[model samples]
Target: MDAKTLERLLNQIAAEHLHIDTLATRNSDRLDFHEVSVWGLKEALQAAFTAGQQSKQTTQPN
Candidate 1:
């Protein structure tokens, strides 16, 4: 998908799995940083991958 759509999807995944407001880091500071467990990271990655796969399936022509 396009950049905007991808960003939204990533943000959604982060919010759902990591309890993050958004993945867009606005500044180089503690507030912008997060401490996430390996499991949480894995879950978010899996969600993103699933979203991409679903997007591809819908977009590809038969």
Candidate 2:
């Protein structure tokens, strides 16, 4: 995927699964830092993986 599409996908996943306001991570060290449980991290990773799989499927020629 392109940069804009990837950025949107990551933001969507973070909002849905990590409760993060944004993935910019450029505000400040403290503001960018987050405290999350292992379960939440796993959920976010799974969501990202699922999105990747779906994107790959759609972009591939049959």
Candidate 3:
């Protein structure tokens, strides 16, 4: 996909991650499960963001 499309997807993922994190924080009873999920999501987000950044850098003109 093009850089713009990739960037937009990443933004959506980030927004969803934030929403999930907020829900996790609000539900204290299932905190452990939610926290684990949030951690996994965070890792995935970081990896995606890193890949997107690398793609953008390589595609840009010097």
Question: Which predicted model would earn the best TM-score?
Answer: 2
lDDT of 1 by residue, 1-62 (tens): 89999889888889989988977778977768999889999999899889989999999999
Cα deviation of 29, candidate 2, in Å? 2.8
lDDT (Cα, tens digit) per residue for candidate 2, span 1-62: 99999999899888878888898868797769888878888999999999889999999999
Candidate 3 lDDT by residue in tens digits, 1-62: 77677667665665565433332244456642434476768776786878778878988999
| lDDT for 4 (candidate 2) | 99
The number of residue pairs in model 3 that clash at the backbone is 0
lDDT of 3: 0.62
User: Which window of 10 residues has the lowest lDDT sum in candidate 3?
Assistant: 18-27
Give Cα distance to truth, residue 48, candidate 2, Å.
0.6
CA lDDT scores, all candidates in order: 0.89, 0.89, 0.62
Clashes of 2: 0
